[model samples]
Target chain A: MSAERQERIEARIAQLNAEMQKREDYQAIIRLQRAYGFYIDKGYWREASDLFTEDATYEQGVDGVFIGRERIHQVIVKLSGGNPGPGLPFGQLYERFQLQPVITVSDDGQSAFGRWHELAMLGQYGEHAEWGEGVYENRYRKEGGVWKISALHYFPNFVAPYEGGWAVLKPVEGDWRSPELADFPPDAPPTVNYKPFPDQFTVPFHYPHPVTGKAVA
Target chain B: MSEHLLDALEAHLDSIELRIARQASHEAIERLQRSYCYFIDKGLWTAASDLFADDATGEWGQSGVYRGKERIRSYLALRGPEGLGQGELNTHITCQAIITVADDNMSAKARWRSDNMHCTDGTGSWSEGTYENIYVNDGGVWKIASMHYYVTLICDYDKGWIAGDIPMDPPSETLPPDAPPTEVYESLPGAYLPAYHYPNPVTGEQPKKPDLPELPESGEDTLADAVAALSTRVERLEDQRACEKLQRSYGFYVDKAMWNDVSDLFVDDSTLEIGGRGVFLGKKRVLEYMGIGLGPTGPQREQVINHQQFQGIVTVAEDGKTARGRWRAFVIGGSSWAPVNWGDCLYENHYKKVDGVWVMDKLHAPFTMYTLYTDGWHKATTPNTRPESFPPPPDLAPTVVYLTYPNYYCEPFHYPNPVTGKEAPPPNPAAGGVANMADFASEES
Candidate 1:
């Protein structure tokens, strides 16, 4: 057996392992995002917040920006109807069904960005039930051998009444920011100004079309 | 050694190719079926029919069977030309599926649900159906072997279902089908369930009755199905999963403040008791209590209350008709304007199987503790909500009244403890297996 042959065999194995690891990482990052979504759905604010890095930025729709893990955690707790701690309060349904994830890992495998569609079933028992459609362009960091959210951004397309649905949805009244978070205040202004539903905003695609390999405008 | 490595590499490549081939079969069938629907949506009869194999059989509702690729094209061509006109809208959105590729990789079966809309001239109609179709691998390209489209209903766009069901036209007068209807059955009003090509993936259980006659070389149990059936644990796991799904789904519904969806989880005569607010009898009565107490229906602009259900201990009855579960919920309540609070509760719930569907028959929840998020349980505590706290009262009075937080009340378990049946309890060992620093110190040095 030649030394060159052994070297070639070893290199082939290494290549396969690297490819497999990337696929595994893709699944793991998706799992992390999905778990984060489940935590948010159940109003497990602390759990949802823990999925982020120490320094992370959280932004949703026109809700400006909240920076830092602690601040973002507080904002997550506040944004999810202001019930803090282990669980959501009774009669509040904030189901964020994480769906259709298209993830892309960087060359180093240390960072990745995922585009996900969020079909949110939001409501309060007896109050008002809303069906929300949104897209998430989130960034994740691999630190300490675990994937965590680095920057979270969600483009809310619409939040319409469950009864009439999106068909009867009127345009946003103002900035679409929850009035409750007014006192908390965002660290920065919204990344972009946009209207949803009746109006249109294409949440930028993180990856190009598979076949065309052309950027999706 | 180099020869051995080369052989190993060959084996590895073979394994990868085998897995890829199976997956490719799934993708190919999905693409073929989806493309057929897309072509059909635009009245591209020739293009859609081209997807059919040389000797494929196509069945549409009560329409007689059309055999062969050319005959299939002729049948579809009855719908008119290549493409629809301006006001002539024909939209077909097909989604949700169960795809099964043969272990031999030569054949496949798929079930698809389609929602269709068609507007001819000015008259519009809606159509919905299930497609239990078959596909064959021709060399490497997959093509439709059998397309069985069982229509659920076709109704007027405005009137809907019973009020406006548009009956299926008899065999086209000019160009009739090759043969009689395969499995004749009426739409909507009739009870006709098409037999699934594959059994339950988990339990490997298929219902006793299968309506349609089998096609060639398919619908038989595969090796995976046989292996899945060998496990006695499958049925229990399936039952347990169903119960867990119910609890998780109920929790999510409540988290979004969707009482209507939450209430729908319960049976018509189900009973619910939240805290000491008393038992809310029947689904409607429970909903009435919520509608009256919680204020309105839907997402609250400022307030949020999430009853996060967790740690469910479910025990299915021997008959499998009923089940009891005990679950705990940690409540996060209040709004930005209002003071936020934390609460924990225990639930002893009962579920009953009706028409093969599991619905909550009884939801008995007992509040354990309630405290302000700012003040903490050690400092400030909120009293449990009561009957008088809300306006229109409950249907029944409190069953078991108890004090919450600063006080303790055990919510009795519905199932006996797993360890309770043990003859003896093991004594705790203090130091026998304890780690000694000296034992591992040499390795560290």
Candidate 2:
């Protein structure tokens, strides 16, 4: 190719990268973070799966090596459907994540990651409550002109039990009133609230695998 | 973050990657705790020695001295199983274990039971203790670096009281002398007696079905099941630790001035070392030391006693059975000339799992420095306890005894000092041996 043409090509590439940083894309990244926390808190496994790219990496739990969308789904499944609250019984939980400090864009303008110090808790559906406290190390990438979660990590600082046992989730502090939760019989036992106390933090998916950036087929 | 800065940061991180590899796991914590306890419980000196940093300064309770890891290891070998057989084995049952990871998860504070135990066999044997530990997670493994084992209760059953039943052996030097006519009894009287029999309650005989409490059966779960079960265990441990009710209980022991509860913090045949005060052999001696030193009759002489500046650090080993800690205490002793300045030495502790529960086996108080009205106190605080120039005390000397409270009156005497009434020149404490507060005072004065 001619030198002039080469310069033009490079210029075009830069322009395209800049175009990827549209306001919508930034908002989408924020939504991705919110969706990840929301789905997990509300037990919306399927929706949470869609927030990530088909082949995106998801690291969950203290060990951190837990990887892959399938593995991520597995952890979500274990968390949502397994012992303790197991989701459905808890109703549609209203989950809120307060992102703090500031979320930054990538220098290359192609990828961005947010180190969010999150204070998250859960309660019965329609109840404004919390379960415990933790923080998130989240990553986002612009793929096919859209921002999607490339990697998501969660770290817990403390795991204190809620009043309603290990299943019924409760926040540390907040006025959580759930009038809609009256569907359960007045004599219904409170759901067990389960919390995981993490000591070891491992990189998700300890199994050796190439870091593939291409979307999953 | 700039690429250059990020790359530099990553490189720095890589250099210290070796530390990351040694980061302690929950299991490693449990193992270290178990190893230390086993070292004390079964007297597995070799295994116990391997659990600490090679260059560690260990206090095997007050009984084991601290110099280097090698010295501690040798000491363990020298004080083998013979030291273990005395106390009826009791397990440490931890309901909550709180760990804070440092140096990439190599160190932590593991706090659990503030409760103590009394012998069911009426032998009056008990092991009540507390711990604050600083650990190093080495290569994904947890090893104790420094541990403070505070024996809140260290009482033993009178062997003479249960001679025929329970096949009681005469109290070894390693065990506490709970018999009558001993000097310790002269100071703290009526503190020991048989609690309950291990065998049938009526016969007062060693129960064939030993009355040892049964541990809750872990649900049928394989190692793979640990993925879930371990998570639950970790969570439960954390919650138990966070509960204010539990932490408040720990404050109770120190606040209530229950030093005899030291034995309950450790397993049977556990050792405790007081850097200044002479080493106390077993749980029995531990109780004696506390009763005579920190207890009501000790320097802590006061009717409305108050011990301020109490802080503790607990390190729960990955193995679960063993944990270590350091508890700092600022004591106020109202003497005539000047108030006594005492800092309870850091305790090096080892917990073991006997029948699946954690119990302390060896505890050591290695570093204690007191500021007295006398000038000798400054030199007394040095790490070294044995001084070269000081001659050894005679094999046995009359023990120090004094009355308690308002009628308190006792004579001040120097240890290793000839009773002939002549004080020797100060010695170089650098040469480690075994010296007491008297030696420290004489050298400083």
Candidate 3:
């Protein structure tokens, strides 16, 4: 091959490597998020919180944002009734289905953004059963070659009795943000003031519409 | 540069190219699996069957295993007629696809979850299941080789699984399936654990078999060979990303009723089929079909059309000019005057690159079920046989009669038994003999 051709080939290889890295980065970040779901479902609070970066931020419903891995761990443990161990007792269960994901990896491959729908069914064996729906807009950072949650913001759309459904009962608000568990207050209130079902609100999109290239507000 | 340095450079380039090709394969396989849901949702049996290899085998629910492309085609056709009928709704929304590609790039396995909602004949139900599917690269085109779906739960919409009133099994009233249940598993209210296709991605140990393929030896590879290989790898990756974006764009456009924009996403000779509305051939007819749903003017102020696409698995052809995709759509739509409705659907669509831009070649959506939100799927189960008044009337009739939940019916599979490679066995005389009522009681106790 000519010298010029060889140089061109070298440049092309560099580009290919970069593209491959980006794709792998996206996959890693998604798997990381999924792993978090698995851990949380079983109330493995420490393991779930460990998936986050040291400086990660965690927020849910109206709960004030909790900064750093420690704070996240604290909040999760408290929510699990202080027993953040793996596997719930015989009568207790918490199953969460993390569905409907739209993930976008940044061009540089250092970070990524994702949107997901959460459908959770949780309760004790003989006690009341609860059904919940929420949306998560999260960010992940590639730290030391491993993906970690940099920020996790969950917006609760509805949490209601499994019997009456979201239609009849009002979802309890501001309970997720228990001040006692937080290291400090959240940076701000809910990003969007949207009530639960019957009343509808479109969550803001972080990326442009796939085809139109128009922002989805 | 020294000859030694040149050789080193050439070797590095080859490695990069190999990595790119491997990554591209992963993306393609994921999309191909997702596209299956999209096709089956709208009763596009032919389109759905086309995704499988000629020798593929499949088993879904209690449906007997089907072997070969022709058998798969015939089986799929049994779900419904050529088009969806009035008031019928079938939605199969798949998620959590754990795909593991083989080192040889010839075969792979994936596990997915399907959350389903069905409404027909004045009744509705909710069902959840899992899929352990395998894929193969045949002539550079990836196709499903074996697909097995194990339904985990089937419940009445109104009662919900928590109520514990609804029976897990539908009355054994339907005709015997091609085979008996592969494993006697009961839905929720029963204790059944369908087997996993692969070991856990984390914590669980990897299986010993199916070792990764060996890397290519760089010693004899020339600089020219490296360049050619890298070029192809780069192109495949680009094609994979573009196809995914194209499929996602379709969902966004239709959600807001961007009729013209949605129509433009298709090729001039492309076709569109929604539910049982029949096939709309060509760009003009496709746009007209959209008009029938959204009014010629586009989305009206009172309309709320949210069609969320999820669990996309796309496969770009090795040639890089054509691709196939599978997706699941969760639809919620209504207007001020109309009653609110919600449903789910599956899409097995195809695309081709035209002038370097990916466009829809064929779009098929077969719904699992659609129902009135007020009455819930349980009480208002409505068959989507043929709408009383629908625009661009279907040019075709449904292929068969199959009701959604509370009434058991299995959609045909595209592949056969994964392990035996044999066609699903015929229903045993004792099959469905005694409803496994014990399985249901096991959960409560």
Candidate 4:
């Protein structure tokens, strides 16, 4: 073959391999988030936390930022039930669905960001049922050919009783920090504070307009 | 052929083969994960545990960790004997898998979501969670290497999450694990984000805006140029896509009450049967059924009748001429003036390929449940639509008489369990059954 033709073939091969790797990475990332949701649903706190990096940052609602994989793990457990439990007490129901993901991988394929919505059905038997909705702008890193969450920032829109639903929710009064993390304060304060619902707030898009390919203002 | 040409062709073949192998790995892993869920659904602990590798480790929420395949089997069986006894409901509806297979196709990792409906000893609970698992291809069979289920929530069926958050059982004292609780946490009311094991699935880039003429007209100078360009277009049309498109098109047309377009999807001998409305055979009768029974053509003011189709399981036959599908429609119908309602309907429809086009043959929909929007299903439910409930009559009597909500009715399965290959057993009555809500229980009686 001509030298130029050989060069073209080699370039084509490299391109094909790169595309294949990226596709695999995308699928793996989505599965990782979904797996996280499943674990949260069943109160498998430790297993769920294992998916994060050693120095990951965890932030939910206005709970601020909890650093290190261990502290975040403890923070999650504290917020979920308070005690050292791998499961929820009987009668409690937690169904947090991970839906409508908009993920953006970087050029080098080593790091990426994701935007996902969470629809939660949380309640206790015969007492009160609450519905939760939130959006997550999360970051992930590839470690040793496997992906792990590097930073997780969730903006909880509302946690309203299921009776009248979010319609009955009143605007936030004072600090909206979670009570579970009150005693064990986060390593740092929340990056941004905003009230949920009634008082509208867009959690800010992390990607450009899909069709127009323009920055999302 | 020149040696260089042969080399190029060989390289292309090698890449194609590798891609195909990776695709196969994906399929195998997905099936393995789903099969594991199916076995657990029926309390088949042994079957579920066997899907794991001989040296696999198992861990449930706060259960600590069980080492070895034997210990994992014991850990799972802690739920009690297999094939759950009467009045027990252990349903784990797991879906939405994001799987990644190794380049060598030896080991794989996956993330899965599982929705649970568990009822034991007359009490029901709803819970859901995620699974981050490792799988190994052992002797040409994929087995779970490490199974981790992170609990999201488990709430009481009656009270809900806010009021009825349940805690997981602490590490079992009776049957201890090799390791103490690895991670402990509360679910909602308590908040925790499961660390995602995979990175972001997309790119962060926008193409530069094209620098072109501000306004451009049709570049074609003659009609022949435009016609010839149209003929050059290519479409990705296959059997499955064609069938799905045809069925989905029916739903879009029905949403607007477009009787003509909806009827056009069917052929001369096509049949329609919804709920207890009986059969309306032939294309002409199908139009009558929609036009008269479902109102005039096109949407009306202040009315909403959206028959949104979702979760279709389409199966094409070997002959490439006929296909069958099972689909579900979540309907949102009513008017601003009239009362609003929510409904769920199940479909078992048939299609045929005629003259290189797919057409609807038989559309049989059974209304599973319907309720008033204000009251919800727990408080208010509408029964099946009877033959005499509406204006226009049907061509034949209703097929398969069945009850709706307030009275439990298990719809027959179109396909068996994917792993077991056996049809699911009929559903048992929950708690008191029909007698509790019988006519005598009401005030009028």
Q: Which candidate should be chosen as best, given lDDT against the real structure?
A: 4
As for candidate 1, its interface RMSD to one decimal place is 16.8
Give the TM-score comparing model 3 with the true structure, all chains together: 0.44
List each candidate's DockQ score: 0.07, 0.01, 0.03, 0.01
Docking model 3 quality class: incorrect
lDDT (0-100) at residue B320 of candidate 2?
A: 58
Q: Candidate 3: deviation at residue B404, Å?
A: 32
The lDDT, on a scale of 0 to 1, for candidate 2 is 0.37
Top-DockQ structure, candidate number: 1
True contacts kept of each: 0.01, 0.00, 0.06, 0.00
On residues A163-209, what C-alpha lDDT tens digit does candidate 1 reach at each position? Answer: 43454555676767877687888999999788775554556667653
TM-score of chain B of 2: 0.33
lDDT of 1 by residue, B1-445 (tens): 4465455444543343343355556656755675566567556777688788889999999889999999999999888876665445455555445677776779988876565656665566656676889999888878899999987667665444445567777777788888988888776433345665654332344233213222223225632222222221234434554665567556545644567767777777899998888888787876777677765665454444556554456778867788988666656566545666656677789988777767788999888666664444545556777888766687788898766644434455454323122121111111112233224222111
Candidate lDDT scores, in order, read 0.64, 0.37, 0.59, 0.65
lDDT of 4 by residue, B309-345 (tens): 5445565776678888766665656664555665667
Clashes of each: 28, 99, 62, 61
- Model 4 Cα lDDT, one tens digit per residue, A1-217: 4666556545654555565566556655765676576456545566567779899999988888999999988898787754333344433455566654656678899998887766565655445556576778899999888888899999876786645555455678899888867689999989988877545455666755332234432
- For model 3, how does the per-residue alpha-carbon lDDT over B1-445 read when each residue is reduced to its tens digit? 3455566555656555555665666656655554465446446566667778888887776676778877777776666785455434354556655566676667888766676655455455666666889988775667889888876556565654434224344312343344555676554444344555543222234323322323344555655455555556566665665565566556655655767767777766888776655677777877777787556454454454557566455667888888876565766566556656655565667889876667889887766556565554444444554533567665445444434322223232222322123333222222112333223222111
